[model samples]
Target chain A: MATTETVAGAAGEASQKGMPQLNFATWPNQIFWLVVALVIIYIVLTKIAMPRIAAVLAERKGTIGNDLAAAEELKSKAKAAEKAYNAALEQARADATKIIAATKAAIQKDLDVAMAAADVQISAKAAESEKRIAEIRAGAVAAVSEVARDTAGALVEALGGHADASAIEAAVSERLKG
Target chain B: MTVADQGLVIDPMHQFQIVPLFGGDTLTWYTPTNQTLWLGIAVAVISLLMIVGSSSKAVIPGRTQSISELLYTFIHNMVEEVTGHEGAKFFPYLMVLFTFIVTSNLLGLIPGAFAPTSHIAVTAVLALMVFLTVTLVGFYNKGIGFLGMFWVSSAPLALRPILALIEIISYFVRPLSHSIRLGGNIMAGHAVMKVFAGFAGVMGIASIVPIAAIAAIYGLELLVAVVQAYVFTILTCVYLRDAVGEAHH
Candidate 1:
């Protein structure tokens, strides 16, 4: 307690210590060291720190710019490839249409030739049948004339009066005509 | 222990005391004091963040690297925007200023730590450096025509002289306000925290209120620390416009 009281008394007595900031006694020391510290900081900054940071920043910017440019190039290349693909697809479609039209025309030509040959064969067979029919009619006329003559002669003989073949033939012929 | 045992003998200003680090009652200009130690700490912290943090030249940034880049770009854009294209040249110097001030300000926030930025000696040096650079650059770039910034041709003929006087006065006051603004804000916040801590020392169980106030004020001081640095940097850029950019009334 005595020691504490004495220390407090000493502090109270020297309470005139005033503002230490106004004490010009230490200003020189403070200024000296401050200038030294500043010079050191300035040297470190200008010589080392500032340049390194700037280089890093600039390098980053360059890398980013290069990456962006490369991306843009790839994008354009992809667009060109897509365009070529579409053009090829369109060309293939046109070729298919042309091939289909050519095939249809070829099929039509073959069908036309087959139908014309069939029509010629059918007309020739009809002509031959007509000729055969004509011949049969002629043969039938001859046979009928002969039968009439025979029957007429037979009748004459039965009636005790004979007749010639020419007369029978003439009469049969006249009746057939009628 | 002696001061603590006294309980209510709260000397808030005692925190700003710059005693010699080694055994001595005298402080020469070269004396390594607490101010020197903290200034060195600020420089080390800045070097750690900027130099070591950016050692990895990753195409993709990691945590510390990204933080370094964030500060770099923030100040970079600020300089470009405020001072136009030509101001880009001073980016490294401005980065130094910003990093130094902010680091000093924040390091001072530690319990029982000395704040170099809170001292007028340090902030005044920084502000004057900016002021000198701007003045020298203005004269170098524009010659005597740089004085046209004070002429204020945009004003009417009768008011031109009056506007010029005001411009000149405000122009000269830049360093004063710049230094004081940062030093004052930091000193005030830290001092206020100390005062509340003194209350906490005396008020027994009710010390919680003062403790809470200190906590809240510490948070404010943290904001103030970064904000004052930002203010200092941006003001540097704004003043730099007079040198590098075309004269605008």
Candidate 2:
């Protein structure tokens, strides 16, 4: 420690100008140079740096704002497009429903017409068959009566009596009536 | 009376010496000295950061550009915070002061480089400039009402005159404290480093301790350099509030 102090003291004495900072001789030179340095710095900054940086910052803010606005616009456009699509889809679905209902009604109408025609044709055929059956029954009855009359005549003739067709017919009718 | 004779080589104050750069016995005001060289270096560094670094004008700044921008925003905010919106006009001046001080302080940390900020003459000029500018701005903005800063209206009328006297003295002392604080901090750190380095030279194997201290103190000094610049600028802003801002006192 003593050696350190002595050396520092000795070095200080050798320099002979105690605390060179307080020395007034160099103050002018330092102040002049300091002024020059500051002026140069000031000019460089004001002229070149500040404006450029400020412009860049302002431009960035503008770009960000513009991009945000653009994004918002696009989003609204997409929403509008989606809404249009939905509306179209709804319209198509309603049209489809209407078409199906109309087709069903038309088909039902055609089916009703065809069924009525078929029913008329079936009823007409049934009525005509019934009339033909009645007619055949009447003819069968006449044939039977004719057979009986002939048989009665043969029997009378075989018994060696007069063969009377009118009387036989009248008696057979009376027996058939009973 | 030499370090060789004293068996220790510590000349802590020698670093503050303003010697001529060219071979000369006399130093004129315009004569370029080591002080001039370092000041020029400080200016170049400032230009590089402010001009070349930002030449890209990139919206998304590159590394150097970001650094310059960061410094810009930092100082800008400081001015705005202290001086309010009206003080924005002084932003360029404060930026110059900040960049110059911080650059020179950092440069001074180089083993043999002279730090202009370590000199009272340099810091006094800076503080005086701030003082004068603040005075000019105060008068310009408020006219005669600028003197209202010294008047303590909040105090009782009987005590106001005394308080005014105190305010006036403190206001004048601002430049002194402002310049000394920066110069003193820088000068002390550099001198301490030199003292430790001188110990390292004489301590043989034990010199590792002083060498280690120098390393540690170097880091502290780096912080000091930046902090002092900040302090100087912030104080400037605070003083500026009297000029540009409404007299809230």
Candidate 3:
């Protein structure tokens, strides 16, 4: 066992005496490979991978920006459309009011013309009725005079006295005048 | 009993040895090693994730695509937050650094797999590259005023020179600490797990203790893997912020 241990210890010492990592000879090789690896990685990243990733990111940003801009534009357009619609609605209301006023005035003008014609007809009918009333009053006066003259003649005859026609007519006319 | 007493010798450091793939007696610089194999695998996996997974470019992403996109956005936001909007231009580099380091660290966690980050060689190169880039960018952008970062304008005139010297030393030490921090943490975590695994081999049914410890340490190492990657990236951003002269100080 002691001999085996000694042999094992000797072997371990032999292996551990000079670590290859500490050897100055192989550094250039490792460094050269390192630079090669770094250069290759740099090329891959800068030329191929990074640009592709940047493109994707840029595309996403651009899409978002465009969507936001379009939304803003649409919102403004909708607002303008609403404004124009409101303005048109206001104009329509004003036009309707003006039309209503004009129509009312036209109707009022027609009403005034009709009222004037009716007034003329009513005045003419009133004048004709007034003339008839005057004629009726004249007839009533003449009939009353005739009735009194006849009544006076009858009364005188019955009383055994003669009544002169011209004298009785004159007496009825004078009494009617009184 | 000692590990050797039970006829079991546990060499925790054995896993770090670099062996030639084709059974060559001596490893040349151009020889394909385990490091090369795993590094290739990591690169391929990353490529598969970032490229082929999103090949369809569906607006609604699948799982792999979602992961890639999440990593992209996460690192992108980090750069933006730490380095500001101007840092956007450097985002690809930051993305590459983050994905590579994180993927390498995670792949290393697999049992019997090699962690490239466990070696100082790989991490030092990464750190040195960042340090050099930041220094160059600072000088390029700020010109002579880049030295103003080291000069302590806020300090008393007598203390300014001493403070400036300290700042200069700290600035130069940045790469050393940056490289070692990641490599050390990863190496230590793996080494400790291996040590515990070695103990489990000799303990028979009582191996439950080391097994439980291994389980717990593995969970911690997994957290460390992501956290170290984050720390490394954020520090890079901070350095970048200074380089771009965006620091309020």
Candidate 4:
């Protein structure tokens, strides 16, 4: 306690106030304190608080570096992802256009095929109708020739009995009625 | 209550009082009981750091445990600055020294805790150790002829003795200077803080000035604590150069 001084006590005191400048420390006592402080400080730093601080700082540094590296990786991945998305979009666009072209070709091909079939069927039906009309016309001409031949035969017979033109016309009319 | 009221005046500086362990040298150096207590506390704390750090020697550090490596690197870099390429070799010892001083200074700044460095004896011992080690290193590296450092090669032959003596005295004074710089600085800072605190107490309403001063001083003290540690380490580096450096080169 000789080494320790109370500032307030020493200052307030009248006679002893001047004694504050004096040092009463012994050599051995100073050495003892020296050794104790050194050894203790050495041991504590070597053992406890320093380790805590060291551990904390190292961890922080490592984590920060790791985070930075991870971020870099993520950025590359994102860029790659964007590129892939763009590529896929491009592929989709091309495929859509190609399909449209194919579809158009297919539709055009079908239309051409349908038109060819319809043309063939329509021509075939028209040819059959023309043949039918020619047969009916031939039959009508043959009927008129037959009627004229019969009328001439009746006129020649009527002339041998009375030679009357009126009788021939009446016979023809009667024949036509029967 | 005055001294008369309590029957005894309480010494505010009781914490710093030196109490003799025995009538004579107590285990080599004069030391008080409180100092012994502080030493034990310091040792315990430092030991705990070692245990925590060496717990797992993982390549990739995890948790707060990795701080051990950063401290290692910090001191390693400091040593390299002082010693160049050779500095890496002294990494462990340098790290140990830096961490110990830095932590001790920081611990002292804590309330009610004694800053061992504030005591001249403690700082003296550290400085002395540094001095002895650097000198031994010089001698070991350069042999007996390293004493030639005291004589500047360019000096005239007649002036050698005086120059040598001056150099020797300065050399002897290294530890004193090294110790005093740290101890004196810490003591004055603490004293100023105490004085400001007293002023604040005396003038309650206008105490903001002292409070502001205290705050500023506290910040400065923290900075000083770091700087002092660095200064001490740097000094060790400079001394080592003297120990191992070529005089002519």
Candidate 5:
């Protein structure tokens, strides 16, 4: 209650003194200070602060733009590298195919040459065996004729009949011919 | 006055008083006052924040530099959005108004500080300047066709005159409403806090209520401080759009 009374008293005093803000006399002073302050602030902001901030912003923008451009350049470079890698991969495949084909042809030629040499040796061995067979057959025929002649003489002596060697040979030869 | 008497006196309005800084028998136009000192302080602080803070112009901004840059972009985008590309020409003006008003409002939140924006003289002058500039630009750019802003071509021909009259009256009332809106809001917030503070003295142990109320109001005033500055600047841009905007026809 005592606090309220003091508050009222203070309010009364303030009212009695008149609100300085409402007082027309001080309006010009306040207005003058306001204008001066605003003008000064305006000049400072426009001339100094704003320009500095703008420069910073522009610098940041410029840096960002340059970064983007650099990124674009790098992206293109990477793409080119990828394309080259693909081209190299294709070339490697093509080269491998050529090497495989060349190896196959060389092996085929060597196989053909080896097969021809083996055929010639087999034919030569067959021809030599045929000649030896012919020689053996001729020797067998002579031995057979001599044995017939000896057999005929022994038969004639045992029988006490005369037998001629030339006649015996002629008879055996004629039989052989027939 | 005795100490008891002084302690009991709850003069909440006393904070708003403009006493001269130097002892003077007569208050003159040139007399330095608390308003001057605080205004100077605001200017100095803004200079420190903007000029000194951004002196390095670092690509990576420091604390003060970041604040300055943020404030610059915020107002820059606002002006661009509100008034289109041409509004950039008035960007510095809007920036100045926003920083001054917001800084002044925030500074005024300090105990025993004066809010320049709370004064009718200050807000009125600022509003008047906006009104005058918008008007002059409208006239200069659009010539007599500026008057067509009041005429609603879309309205029925029979009601066109009435609509135009209303528009004219509302247009003229722009400065009045603009000034009162800012000044009244700031003044009312401060006055309410003062009343709450007065109650604090009388409420004794229950002074907690009044103290809490003051705290809440202070928080609200902080929001109001920034919002009022934004409101004032955006409104300026809206009015400027009328001046430099492209014609529909």
Candidate 6:
């Protein structure tokens, strides 16, 4: 409530001024004082207090508007900062996936190379074992030939004693030649 | 001259008095007449209440505070609403003038009291204050150069002074007329009431009829009290029309 206290106060002041003048002042005297009071009060209200009050109100309005503008700016800045952070997080996730795929590929390549080397070693070992078995079989056949010659010589000697060794030997030699 | 031959010697308006501290030779302070003392007391009491009602007040008002503020606001709005926005500044003078008159008038109704407004001197001073305040407001807002409220500024220069002189005289008379109008009206109303009461007594049992009539008239006086306060305030606003600028009227 915009109270006119100054006016009320002015009246109180005038009343006090009024008291001394009651005995001393006539109608004219009172009128003169009343004029003086009115002029002074009007000047004070118009020049001093009223202007100051209006200025204060105007200043307050400007301050509130400034505050609103500042708040709006801050709100936008926060939104932009949030957007940047989300973009960075998304980029980090993409990088992590790429690294994981590369690791998987590397592990698979190592396993494939190891399996190929093992297959070659097994094939070479099998070929070497087949050659060694052929060599052992040849040695065994030579031993059997020597034993047969010796047995034949013994039989001819025995047959000489029994009178048919020379004729058996001649028939075996002819069959061998044919 | 003791002319109490038939009936009452008692004059309520007279016979009561308050002694004064200081002496004076001219318009001097002596024991004030009963009416003056009562009126002065009414003034002091009313002024004190207005002070109490408005000082260091709360935003949400209490009962006494609200009534005081309402009276203040009601007068303020009445001025503004009557005279439009330009009249806003005149609230100070109009408010003061209204409170002083209305308070004094209402006080006069208190059986043993008198209204200072019943005196030509007090009301004339009040009216004079309004007249001066408005004129000063007008002149201040419009410099000494803008005295065109009189005759047509468009009129030939030879005619301006004669017309302007008349306008100035009429303007000066505002206070005298305004004060008397109020003082006369209120004084008549009270005197008539007393006169009728005197009539009722003489008329005996027929006095009941006059008593009823007086009662109705008292009711009318109360209404007039409020109306006169309003009339005084409205005229202040209308007179203050030029307080801002000529366009304001």
TM-score to native of every candidate shown? 0.81, 0.82, 0.72, 0.61, 0.80, 0.51
Indicate the worst ten consecutive residues by lDDT in candidate 1 chain B. Answer: B1-10
Give the number of the best model, judged by TM-score: 2
How would you encode candidate 4's per-residue C-alpha lDDT over A1-178 as one tens digit per residue? 3344332343234224322112333334556655655565555555554555556557767988999999999999999999999999999999999999999999999999999999999999999988988888878765865575566666677677544666555666666557
| RMSD each, Å | 6.2, 5.9, 7.1, 8.2, 6.7, 13.5
lDDT of 2 by residue, A55-159 (tens): 887888898999999999999999999999999999999999999999999999999999999999999999999999999998898888888888888889999
lDDT of 3 by residue, B128-243 (tens): 99999999999998898998998878789899899989999999999999999999898889889998998898899999999999999999999999999999999999999888
- Look at candidate 3 and give me any clashing residue pairs: none
> lDDT per model, in order?
0.86, 0.88, 0.84, 0.67, 0.84, 0.62
Q: iRMS value of model 4?
A: 7.8
Q: Give lDDT: candidate 6, residue B181.
A: 80
If you score just chain A, what TM-score does every candidate get?
Answer: 0.58, 0.61, 0.63, 0.57, 0.58, 0.48
Candidate 6 residue-wise lDDT, A1-178, digit = tens: 1111232343334343432123222343333433443454344434443343344445556777898999999999999999999999999999999999999999889988988998888888887887888888877765655455456767767677443556545655554456
Which has the higher TM-score value, candidate number 3 or candidate number 4?
3
lDDT of 2 by residue, B1-249 (tens): 136764876768877877778855566677788899999999999998888777998878899888888899999999988889998999999999999999999999998999999999999999999999989989998999999988999999999999999999999999999999999999999999999988888789998999999999999999999999999999999989889888898
DockQ head-to-head 1 vs 4, winner:
1
How many backbone clashes can be found in candidate 6? 0
**Poorest 10 consecutive residues by lDDT, candidate 1 chain A:** A1-10
DockQ of each candidate relative to the true complex: 0.31, 0.32, 0.18, 0.12, 0.26, 0.02
Indicate the docking level reached by candidate 3: incorrect
> For model 3, what is the alpha-carbon lDDT of residue B71?
89
lDDT of 4 by residue, B140-230 (tens): 8788888889887688889888888999999999998998898777666666676676667656688898899999999999999989988
| Cα lDDT tens digits for candidate 1, A49-110 | 88899999999999999999999999999999999999999999999999999999999999
- Recovered native contacts, candidate 4: 0.22
> Candidate 3: what is its chain A TM-score?
0.63
Please provide, for model 6 over B1-249, each residue's C-alpha lDDT reduced to its tens digit, 9 standing for 90 to 100: 122756743232321112222433222222233344554565455545555554435444567556666666687678777767887866766756676668778877777566666656667777877888877877887777446676557668898888778877977787877877887777767766776777676777888887888788888888888788778778878777756646421
Q: In candidate 5, residue A118 scores what lDDT? A: 83
Please state the error at residue A47 of candidate 1 in Å: 0.4
